[model samples]
Each structure stands twice: as C-alpha cells, then as structure tokens.
Target: MGCSKKKIKYELSKEFQFEAAHRLIKNYSGKCINYHGHMWRVIITLHGHELDEKDMLIDFNELKPLKKWIDKYLDHTTIIWENDPMLTFFKKNNQKYFITKKSPTSEHIGEIILDKAIELFDNQRIKVKYIEVKESNTSSVKVYSNKY
Candidate 1:
C-alpha cells in the first residue's frame, strides 16, 4: 500500500492602512451611527503549495494591483450600506464612497474584504487564509475562509 503524502505550504501576508468614513445607519447606542472616520488597518493572508518557475508561492509584486484597488475604492472614502439613504446623497454630491450590503462595522468590513478577496484572487492561484481588520490598535477582527 502506498502512503499518503502531505504537502508543505507557504503563506504570504500584506498589511496596510487607509482612511475612510462610515455611519452605522442603525438605531444603535454608539458613535458608529454618527459620521466618523478611521485609519483602518487591513491584513491579507494567502496560502499556496506549489511555486511557480520563479520559486515563489506568489510574487509580491502581483499584490500591487490589490493595493491600487484598495486605494481607489476604500482610501479616504466613505463606506455605507446599500440601503442607507446617505448613499444617494453622497452620489448626488459626487463624493467617493463604497457601498456594501452588509453593515460597515469593523467585523463586517472584515467579512466584506474576505468575500471580495476570493473573487479578487480568483486568477492568483493562491487561497486566501484570512483577513484581519482593525478599527484601532485595541480593536480588530479576522474573517477566515473555509478553504484556508
């Protein structure tokens, strides 16, 4: 009988911060419901087994596109729920913002990032392990993918 084999894996992480604004748009008891901004921090982790001809699980340079995408969409922009009426006003005022179906809380933002990351990395040949989002140094959340 042949023995099963285990493959070694390599992981790569990229972390960055961006400024954005959001309001809970809910009947909650906190400042999240009011307009505010944060220097949000995000970390992206990728896992892979096989390396390309370049002997790398993934080329770090390939992450430039992700950085550009984040800067274009999330940096210094307001994030809002799709159903939030503020979205219409912001659009009409020609402001930059990202609309999501989920609430823009720190934890939910982590979920949103993970959801988009799967599609964003479809052609990268690497599986996303998790995404960690931090609203502040003392507050953070991580969303893991089942494939991880």
Candidate 2:
C-alpha cells in the first residue's frame, strides 16, 4: 500500500479561455498596434501521489465549476498591457473600460491564472505542477511549479 501511493504519478490537462489585447514594444514598429485579439488557451497540469480506483487523479467534470467562472470574465474581453502606448492613446481619447495592471503577454497571463489556481485548490496533496499558455497555435509559454 505504501509503495502504491509513492509510485503513482499522473498529469491532467484543463483548457480555459480569455480574450484580450496587447502589443510588443519595438524599436522599429510596422503594425502591432491597431488593436487585435487572440484565442488564449491555458493548460493546467495536476500532479499527485495516488489515483482513485478509476485510475484518475480527479474527475474531469470537477473542473466545470472553475471553467464557468473563468468564462464569465475572460470570454470575449480584451486585455491591454498597462504600459502599451495604445493604452495612453485610449486614455487621451477618454476611452476607458476593463483593464489589468499586468502585461498581456502569454507569460504574464499564465502567472495570473496560476495564482488563481493555487488559491482555488489550496491543497498541498494534489498540486498544480505547471501552467502553459498558448497565445496562438505557434506561440506558447509554460510556468513551472515552485515545488522544484
């Protein structure tokens, strides 16, 4: 029994969605401004010691609640990097709405979601080992667990 618990290792992936905007600061710019959107994809990895008799760490259905909550704020919304020039322009034009203090980069977004995940789980047993964010099919970044 003791060996079983120690030998078990599993990883599960969950997908989440959020819509936002941002720009990459460039020395010479062509066209990253003009405002754009991305279909952000997040994969949350869970790691643990043992699995249930069903051979699973946790049920997939258990994630529905979190997904519902995330969808409410992330779906169809644009996120602007606070330092982006466009933000200043918008402010000068008296255009203001929902905004975040962090940059809109994939790494930044992953950190935000990871923090929320840690808060929601709040358990040392089943830990979130990594969070990977995909800005597009070709671009992605991963944030690893500090438990390293």
Candidate 3:
C-alpha cells in the first residue's frame, strides 16, 4: 500500500506597471534624496485552498480594478511622504502627487499594494499572500501579508 496526501493549496498572481516619482525624506540617503522617477513593476499573489463554482482560484478579471486604481492614482504621479517639506511646494504648484504615511521606499510601496489587494479581495476563502515591487530591473522587494 502507498500513502498519499490530498492537494489543498492554490495560488494566483497578477502583474502591473506604473511610472512614478518619489524621494526619501527623513532617512539618510544619497542621490535618492533628490526627486526621481522609475518604471515601477508590481506583482501580487493570492492564495486559497478552496475553489469557486467555476473551478478556479479567482478570475484574473477580478484584479483589473486594482490595476485601474493604481493607474489612476499612482501612474505619472509623484509619491511623497506626508511629512516631507517639499509637499508644500508640490501643493502650491498644484502638481500631481500622492501622499503616504510612511516613506515611499520600494518595500513600503509593496506593503501598500498588498494592503489594497487585501481590502479588495480578502475573504473567508481567499487571502493575499505577498507583493513584489521592482523599482529597477535588478532591484526588487517582496512584502508579505501579516494576516496570513
């Protein structure tokens, strides 16, 4: 007789890209202190043990709204830490900007995206697993959800 175990896990992922600018405000940094922009790439993963009536983890179309939200708010916008002094300048000039409570580093950005995904999709059957944010081709950060 052979022992066998049941399969009980599934995962799905989605990728999105946006162009944005940010600066490290309070931390000791180098050239990044100056305003700069990058083509940001984000990947979100979702995990679940149960499938829906359609026999799928979740329809990829369900994630389109998340991409739409990012394109509307973060694309081509300067992301600024709420406490940065330059915020006043951007506000005065009426420039497009997004404010974040924490410094807008790649790691925190991943966390922010993860939080958004959880808010949009998390439920009793499915949950967000992690988010990977790539600020450059060779540099990236993966932030995991604390809920799981």
Candidate 4:
C-alpha cells in the first residue's frame, strides 16, 4: 500500500512594493543630492516542512497576510540609513517612515522583510531557509541558512 502521508517541502514567494529615498555616499550621482523614491520591490519566500492532506507543502493563501504587513508599514515610506545626516531632516519633515541601521540596500532591506515573514510562521516547524533581494531587476543578493 502506498503511504497515505508524505513529507513534502514547499516554497512560495510574494512581491510587495515600497517607496523610499536613499543616497550612496561617495557614489557617482551628481544630483542624487535630492531625495528620490523608488518603486521598491520586496520578494518574500516561505518554506514548509510537511505536506497537508492535499499533498501541498503550503497554501498560498496563508502567505497573503505577509504582503499586507509590508504594504501597511514599509510601502510608501522613506527608509533612512542610520548614519545618514538626512535622517534628522526627514524626521523633521514628519513624513511616512522606516529606519535602518545599515544602508538601505536591497540585501539589508531583504533581511528585514525576511525576518518579518518568518514571524508569521512562528508556530510552524518550517523555516525560511533562504532569501533573495533585488535592488533592480538585474541585481540581487541572497542570505541563506548557513548565514543564520
């Protein structure tokens, strides 16, 4: 007889957007001097250890709320690097916001996004084994389990 239960691994990713401004110090942008926002994209990956009765590792619907969290907080918010002098000025402006101790590169932002996604799976046994962040469609960085 075939085994009724199977242990299957499943992974799913969701994309979200945020708007924020940042400047790279000593970088070559003559007029990056002014604040600018990006149509930032965040991709969150979720992993699951066991398959349910449907032989599914995870239900896509279950991961939807993670997008909601990102949209409400990080979306359309100015993300300031911890060391930037602009931090104080943005605070003074009292605009929508978020703060980062590191430069707001896609990798750093990816970690923040990954951390939040994992929180949703807290009661589950599965882990977010990996994360990949893209600053532009052509460029990206990843963090893996070994780094954890």
Q: Which candidate is the best by lDDT?
A: 3
TM-score, one value per model: 0.85, 0.76, 0.92, 0.76
User: On residues 47-136, what C-alpha lDDT tens digit does candidate 4 reach at each position?
Assistant: 666666776656777777777877777777877677778778878988777888776766677778777766775445466766676656
* TM-score of candidate 1 on Cα atoms, chains taken together: 0.85
lDDT of 1 by residue, 31-138 (tens): 678889999999989887666789886787776776777798899999998988889899999999999887888878888778777777744557889999998899
**What are the per-residue Cα lDDT tens digits for candidate 2 across 30-124?**
46645667888888887787676787777878667656655765666556666666667667776533455765567777777777776665365
Q: Whole-model Cα lDDT per candidate?
A: 0.83, 0.70, 0.91, 0.68
> Worst ten-residue run, lDDT, model 2?
24-33
Question: Clashing residue pairs in candidate 1, if any?
Answer: none
Model 4 stretches with alpha carbons more than 4 Å out: 1-8, 26-34, 122-124, 145-148
Per-residue lDDT over 1-148 for candidate 3, one digit per residue giving the tens place of the 0 to 100 score: 5333235788899899999999996765788999999999999899998889998989999999889989988999999999999999999999999999999999888878888889999999899999999999999999999977
Which regions of candidate 1 deviate over 4 angstroms?
1-7, 122-125
Candidate 2 backbone collisions, by pair: 20-79, 21-79
Task: After the best TM-score superposition of candidate 4, give how far the Cα of residue 84 lies from its true spot, in angstroms.
Answer: 1.4
- Of the two candidates 2 and 4, the one with more favorable lDDT, higher being better, is 2
Window of ten residues with lowest summed lDDT in model 1: 1-10
Worst 10 residues of 3 by lDDT: 1-10
